[model samples]
Target: MSTVHIKPVPVTPAEVIAVARESARVAIDPEAREAMARSRAFIDDIEREGRPVYGVSTGFGALANTFVAPERRAELQHALIRSHAAGVGDPMPKEVVRAMMLLRLRSLALGRSGVRPEVADALAALLNADVTPWVPRHGSLGASGDLAPLAHCAMVLLGEGWVLADDGSRSEAAPVLDAAGLSPITLSSKEGLALINGTDGMLGMLLLAVADLRHLLVMADVCAALSNEAMLGSDRPFQPELHEIRPQPGQALSAANIHLMLQDSEVMDSHRNDLAHAVQDAYSMRCAPQVAGAARDVLAYAETTAARELLSVVDNPVVLADGRVESTGNFHGAPLGYAADFLAIAAADVGSISERRVDRLLDVTRNRGLPAFLSPDPGVNSGLMIAQYTAAGVVAENRRLAAPASVDSVPTSGMQEDHVSMGWAAGCKLRTVLDNLGTLLAVELLSSVQGLQLRQPLIPSPAARAAIAAVAPIAGKPGPDQFLAPVIEQVRHLVQGPALRAEIEAAVGPLR
Candidate 1:
């Protein structure tokens, strides 16, 4: 196997996902290290020269006017981390915590934050060693750069908070530091503020969401193909010339994916007889690409926005090479806030259509002679009847979460944090949508797979067959009214699996 070299040039959501899945270690580029070193030297010089600098000589938030006594500088740094570590609720998942560490390392690697190389190295070591800080799931207003959650992360670096170690044990950072033969990071100059003030917390969740959503979209196409065969729907909508008239990249790609998955299927050919009876398929089957395609466009937009953000230097009071410390709003998360909301909406749409296709497969009249509820015993089993309800409920919740987080801003920090983005909410909601979407699509997959089995002796597309095979080990065909929760969970895991997702993407190509 060839090795893939990941440069620290600019990380995208897809790249972040790839790194997370591949378990690749991250390191700062040499030039970026030099840049950071230069900025740190400049910050030291600024303090020595008795120059006034924001968040360095002066206080933070509502107290920006207060000057810090030289002797109290260390106290100021420690206080910053201790006070901001106010996040509460359940701990974030270990994978998410690791992603946050990676994003933070990358941003600091940009060299504008004036953080020490040791600080970046510590974060990198945490990721490389799989030592993840136990960050909470709530308490961020998206102003001051996810201050609460990020402070929890910074606390771990200071060997003061809890962390999940590689041995799958939760340990206090101080003890872990002793065990690992490491020391806590001491805050100097702008270091503590730099470590705590960034968009990494929100961006980490968004990056993971984007990765999972990409797979969901791909599986959605395969499910659509299976439903198309079961419904005996005309493939006219996917004709390249048909979409070329409008020429949406997403539409065109969706068309190609469906066409590929349905190619050479006898069931699709039999659908030609029905095409003469019906002019077009119902919106669910014929318009699958259009609906799923629009979401593809949205995914592209979200990915672009995240890529730009992960590459940005997001700490406050950026230190420059010329000994200038400019206090600005680089840490604000408005861009990612809107992008997360957009991603939530887009991912929810994928689930919405998947549920619709489930409806199409379950409706016997609409399903073209398939048994009711997709079971051997229709009245007795009630097969898949409530599955649709669960799928619908999840889709509804996603719709509720799609509301724009960037639009609602609450003031905090004595109104010094006024006009907040609440981006952490957006990122968290995006992940929720992803998780819910997995189940929703799993229902669709179960329904579509059963429908295809009813058409046995008539094959599905190669891509669809691979997906069915991947799911079979985890979720077999519905035999009775057995408990579906386990089956559904397994299906969700399969849907999120790398091989299954890659096959679907290879068949479908880039989501528009």
Candidate 2:
């Protein structure tokens, strides 16, 4: 297995994916271990001196007014994690739970959480051994961290929760921990609180969403190129100089991508001097770069936020270099919540444009004279008529899902957390929107590929031709509409990932 050394540095989405998927193992940095020792010593001092440290001597939440004696401190932490593991609904996906665990480990390894180095080691061991905790999907308020979900994750470290084995067997966490050659760790002072406090869950989902949408946005640009070429739309709008006037980096990049991918096309050159050709294409055909590019700009902001969060130690009563521990409100998830919601809005709009392009490609009135629906038998066969309906349905759902979850909040923790980020909710909705967008892009790509094929003896650009060829096995050439549901599903699976992108890039170099 590839081993990832865990330190107090910011991590990349790729690293998170590698460890979360178990393609990589984790190791503790020696310096981090030493730092944890020192932080733990500071906590020890507070306890020995009998000062009512927040999580150490005092009870939690509004119950902070209550104090516990030294003898019951260990029980206090166990009770804390057990009580907080109160989430409901189906379990989160294994990868999301794994990513949360890995991120929480990164935060604790910073040595500011006052956790014993052994706690970090146990978490690393659990991840490396592929013992995934079955974290519940709901109940996080996103204010005092992702308390419910993270608590479920933290429970597996203490051998009190359910574990899903790599072989798909489910068992009690204690036996699974033993099988992995690990034992439950007793929580030290402040350890339980640290384990659950952070914006890591929402941040982890946001990080994954950013990585995914980056690829999908590129795919959207490629699909847009195909749609424009099929519509015989002018490429003059994609002129580099024209984009330079506006100077949006994302817009410029998208225009450059279309400019390069559609270069040297026989079909495009054929209509260059045809005065009969329409002066300009519809906005969906002409304004693709602006729409897709603006989404790219939003993604850039999300990436910046994710990078800063990766390096941050987000917890209350964080340990300082001078050996002081002070409670702070760094656990608020507003930054991640806003980023997730914004990306959802962008993804939904991208899907909206792609859906419109699908409609234009299938309509006889708007399709610029391809066979109606590109059907070989025309009126006799229904062709891809219903496919547009499916795309429209998904796009409409995405529009609804795009409504910002961050703007809504509900009181919890006895009104102590009256305002919440709802970032977890936002992250969940964004994932659904992104998945729907991929399906919508797949439909657009299948429709465009058919339109290009029907244009036939009229050759397209080398990149467009190669994409048609690459997807032929899945989308096939237009004929009497044959069982389109399976074909659409096959095409959706291919376009949802890097295969078609690989073919396009091979002919046109890097798209970015």
Candidate 3:
């Protein structure tokens, strides 16, 4: 298990993914510990002076004006955690919970949250012990951080709430903490606010989505190239000169990848100069780079937003280097909200265009020389006709999901937080959109491989041949229609995993 060291600076997206998805150990840096101690001294000084701070001495949200005596401050902090851990619905995936914990720990390590070093260490301990808090799917509005979700995680540090072990068995948190040789720490001044106030959940989802989409976008190009070959379509539109004139970086990259994938192809060579067959292919084949490239541009913009958010200090009443703890609106999740929504839209379009190609490959009129639905025998065998329908259904659902969760906001906290971010909802739905996209691309791969096999004697390019070989075991040569749902699932696994990309890259250097 690799370990990710957390410093006061921005952690990389790769580090977050490793810790979130790979059970990577997390270690706080010595510098970060020193920084946390320094930040804690300022809070201690304020406490000793009896100077009221927003979250330390006074109340939160709509109750900000209410002052709490020093004697009741501990109870105030405890109540905050208990009240905010109000999430409902099914528990979130273990990976998402781990990511949220890691990000919150990073925020504390940055020394802006005015938390004791022990608080941060407790989080690291839970992560190293593989004890994940059971955070529910609903309850976060994505404003003022992922309050309910983070509160559930904070509850684990207090020996309250439920947790999951490495084997995924659910149990009470206190026993798990004891077995792991960990002790729950009592919250101090502003610690509860620090724990729950940040955009970690939404930001973690955004970083994970960015990583997944980067790979899927390249795979989209691979699928588009294979579909083009299977349909005997022209590669003229993908010429470097054609894209160079327009000069959209992502567009040019997609065009170059498709052009490279089509190289050394007997199928393409057979139709190199056959103008009589057709002047050009449909938009699904000819304009793939344009659509896919636009998606790449959206992804790039989202990546930039996520990178900036990773470096931000998102807590209210952040401890300043000037020795003042001032409240700020950095916890608002609008930026991450927009990024998640934008990526959802981009992913939907990528799936949409891939579905179009799948449709064309199954249509006898559009499939060039292939039989209806890529069937071995038309009419008698329904073939992959239902498979296209499945892809279409997923695409429709994705379209509905792409309807921007960030755009809708309801006031909360007695209207003190009037205009919530809904960023968490955006991240959640974006996940579903990406999952559907994998299936949509899988359908395209399944149909294209069948069409290529039908074009037998004339082989595809080396990269295409490598792709066909990768999916062969999961989906054999097309024949009488059999159990297609299982085959689609198998192909989806191939599409989502690293093996298919590895095989293709092994044959053709690397793709952009």
Candidate 4:
């Protein structure tokens, strides 16, 4: 993987995804190092003058009014990190941890966190070495900038916490650093506060969610097209002129994609002039573009918010270019919280509609001439009966997870940090919703491909054919059901992976 050079400018979502999911190495730009050094001087001046700054010379949160003696200030920094590292739950995924590390490094490199150049360099070194700290899944209220989760990451910088090896076993940070030819750094003044005081954890997850949702949204369109063909639904609703009149960008894009995918389809062409077909199909078939397109628009809105946040310096007591160390509320995670929650709601609806399409494809009466559950021997073999149940189960779970986490906040730090954002919780739930959405789409693909196979003499469009061919090995022809769970999982992998998209795009050009 190529190195993702960190500069003072905002980092892109792609860079975050590359570093997080692809294990890309990171390096600090020279200009960013210079900026960090310049900012460090301001903190040093405040320290020398004995001025009482929020995190520089005084305590934090509820203890902000407390003063620390000069001699014990270093101990105060260490104590802050140790006490705040109170996260509890299963360890976060390695990708999330890595993304958090990269995002923190980006914030530091922006030269606003009042840390020494070496502090930023240490974070970059950790990323380059692929040494991820073991951050917990819980303990962040999303206000005060993901305190506990970031504190766990900061502990690794001090060589005081646990780090995960390549194989995922944990070891002491000191030994890991030693093996990696790195040493722990002593914290001075605001360095510890700077390290842990940011919304990096929530932002990292949001960016990752954005990247994944982008792909899944396109796949949503693809699956809708496949399901439409399988159920012999009309393509008239997806006409360019029909969507052009509405002019919702996402809706137009979705309509265009479905319209193009159904071009030259024998199944669709077979019924193009049939007078007996229903004047309008069910909402799941006729309004796929509206539902999936609205989800696309929501994802775009989240992306816009994420882009603005990528340029943000989300820390308390940020150092200013005018030589003042000021305390600010930039660390509040409300924006990220709202974005994650909104995306979750949209994703859940998309999954819900996809499951509806799966049901339509499985029903004997509704699936036109297809078998019940698409089984060759309907009663003897339970073709995909349980698969619809699985999709329905996941859709219900997605709906439950879609309840906005941002609206529920609990005060902490003795009410000093009240009205927390809970953005991290929102991001966590969005991840699950997206994962479930992928599974729901996979189930639809499984049933739709079987439906299309049963429509044998009348071929699906080239793009649908390409999609069916891609999953044919794993999801074989419409026959007696074999072990179904493994096949659904394998198809889910294909849905989430790039190969299926590549094949479809190859046949019908790119989807929105």
Sort the candidates on lDDT, descending order. 3, 4, 2, 1
- The Cα local distance difference test for each model comes to 0.79, 0.87, 0.92, 0.90
Worst 10 residues of 1 by lDDT: 1-10
Reference-based lDDT, residue 51, model 1: 74
Count of backbone clashes, every candidate in sequence: 0, 0, 0, 0
Two-way lDDT contest, 2 vs 4, winner: 4
Sorting all predicted structures by TM-score, with the top scorer first, yields: 4, 3, 2, 1
Where in model 3 is the C-alpha error above 4 Å?
165-169
| Candidate 1 residue-wise lDDT, 265-365, digit = tens | 77777667653557877888889889888888888888788778866878898876566788889788888898888888878887888899899899888
TM-score of each: 0.93, 0.97, 0.98, 0.99
lDDT per residue for candidate 2 within 1-512, as digits (tens), equals 48777876666778898876655888989987888888899998999899987888888888877999899888998899999999987777777877888899888878888989999988898887888887777988788989999998889989898886555445789988898898899997788998999988998898888988999999999899999898888899999999999999999999999888778888788789999899988999889999999999999999999998898889887989787888888898999999999999999999999999999998889888887877878888978899999999999999999999999999886877788899999998998999899899989988898998888798899889888887788767888778878887787777777788888888889988
- What lDDT does model 4 reach? 0.90
**lDDT of each residue in 1-512, candidate 4, tens digit only:** 58899998878888998999888888888999999999999988888899999988899999999989889888998999999999888788899998998998999899988888898888888888888898888999998988999999889999999997667677899999999998898998898999899899999999989988888988888899999998889999999999888978899988888888989899998988999988999999899999989988998899999999998989889889998888888889999999999999999999999999999898988988888999999899989999999999999999999999999989988999888999999999999999999999999988888889889888789988998898899978988779998999999999999999989889989887
The runs of at least 3 residues in candidate 2 whose Cα sits more than 4 Å from the true structure, single-residue gaps closed, are 165-170
- What is the Å distance of residue 177 in model 4 from its true position? 1.4
| Candidate 4 wrongly placed segments (more than 4 Å) | 166-168
Residue-level error in angstroms, candidate 3, position 1? 7.5
Tens-digit lDDT track of model 3 for 150-193:
99999999999989655655689899899989998999888998
lDDT of 1 at 15: 51
